[model samples]
Target: MTLLRDLPLSALRALAAAARTGGLTRAAEELGVTPGAVGHQLRQLEDRLGVKLVRREGNGIVLTRIAEAALPDIDRGFDALASGLRRLRFERRADTFTIAADPSFSSLWLAPRLGNVRAALGKLDVRIVVSIALDSMLEEGIDLAISYRYSSARDLASADLFTERVIPACAPTLIRNRSDRDGVEMLDRLPLLHIDQTMGDDVYPTWANWFTAAGRKRKNIDHGPRFPLTVLAAQAAVSGMGALLASELVLRQHLDSGQLVEIARDVPALTIKRRLVWPVDGPKARRASAVAMALAAVARAEADGLRSAVS
Candidate 1:
């Protein structure tokens, strides 16, 4: 309860340590200082306060009633100060931002474009967690949630990123090297890599959907090496494991590189729009807005590229 505004932080730290450890020697060892230095600090503090903070006891220092009562508050102040310093260091290091997205979008879409975003927003740390269930942006610590949905919940804000269109694609080798093979015939030689979402009991775009859209149904749509994510299925196709139903967003690079070639032009799958959702308030909302702007720019460019390709 004494005024000690002009006291040095080091002296305050030393007093806090001696009080906690019950002796100057132990406190000095813990603080990597000599016992005499700690003792000097305690004496200086007592002189400043005009009180006897420590009393001589058998082989140890005993705190006076005033020191005992005040030490806990002093300790708490120092702890709070240390915590604030740590937080300041983290904030100075970089602003942290986290996005919640589906695995397919993360691996196939956002992951590829993250470098551009990083370049645009320097000294910003970004993380992505994949899950199908919609997360409350405030509750789950998400800055943004990208989902294939019509609208965000009433409590959340939203932006429509872009729509998804798919095409049947296979390794270029399959078509270039096996020119004699037809769609049905090629199935026997090359695997029909099916994305096995049955385990999770989720409805996902399948080879059957593509075939049916083309007015041709392959009875063996369910056959081949199965993967949980569409991105994995696309990779399998890239590796020549089999053909996959590739979303336009996921396979843009492969199609451009001639790594994956469209098997049929007639089968255009149903389009699905990706929406960005975020909470109305907090640090996360600000981060989400910045990220959404960058992402929207990317989506626009992609759409333009697709338009050129289609034209």
Candidate 2:
């Protein structure tokens, strides 16, 4: 009628140590405790079990007959516990993957397609770190990074994810009555939302840059509410605040959902290369390569879909 929950784990450990080491002093040394403490734990265990578990035999101690009979199973149980702990740690490391990306890409692109990534990765748990700096990859233990900047370092492998494309877009309500004007004129009329120019790799185009690409001149190009992240600017555009020079790749959900509509189809889209990078020498390199392939495939498929839709 003794319940396993009522048994003290310390006492069980002391018993195992004593049985394995053959003496209380040696057991105490193995357990990193005093011999007196080990003896006390054994006494507690014996009292709880209503049995004489150990006996003094000259200068050393010996397990009693009943204790000796139980020692093998006890040793097996301890071994199983240690083995289980090791397996748990190993499985945790095996199943978890860490990736780094910029906040805008992480929020607008990668965050939405994670389910696809998960399916591609099987049971691995993907951890996304919001960062664009490749320098911190080793220090932060990042398994892979999706970044706009590519590195030619000998120790790293890089694969192109996709070229980020940006187009001018805004809520339908913002352009509801402006049907008479062309895309460029409509963009000229609407307030221009801006993502902070200094934030990313200067790849994100500004309203001025978009106008130049369109061969038009507009004043006060920087005269809109500025956001530090592209995702934030996309949200502002969705709220009918202003026309956003939005990343077509990153903010596709908003455009697909009709939360935002492209105002300038004739204007040339701006583009920046985004790539996947990972250490070639690490234990996770193979897994990272597999994940990189999956991510690139997903991006390519989506990009193809977008192109098809646009055409």
**Candidate 1 C-alpha error for residue 236, in Å:** 2.0
Kindly report which residue pairs in candidate 2 clash with one another: none
What's the true lDDT of residue 267 in model 2?
63
* TM-score (C-alpha) between model 1 and the true structure: 0.57
Which segments of model 1 are wrong by more than 4 Å? Answer: 1-95, 107-124, 176-190, 196-203, 305-311
Question: In model 1, how many backbone clashes occur?
Answer: 0
Candidate 2 residue lDDT tens string, 23-64? 999999999999999999999888888999999888888889
lDDT of 1 by residue, 1-311 (tens): 23655646777788778777878899999899999999898888788778988887888888899988988888888889888987785565347677777687787778889876775455668778865345445555666778764334566788888877766778877774434333444543556887665321244567676666666656566777877777777888898887787567778788899888877553345566677777767755666677787888898998899799999
- The per-residue C-alpha lDDT of model 2 at residue 130 equals 69
Q: Which candidate number would show the highest lDDT if scored against the true structure? A: 2
Best by TM-score: 2
Write down the worst ten-residue block by lDDT for model 1.
Answer: 176-185
RMSD to the hidden true structure, all candidates: 11.8, 12.8
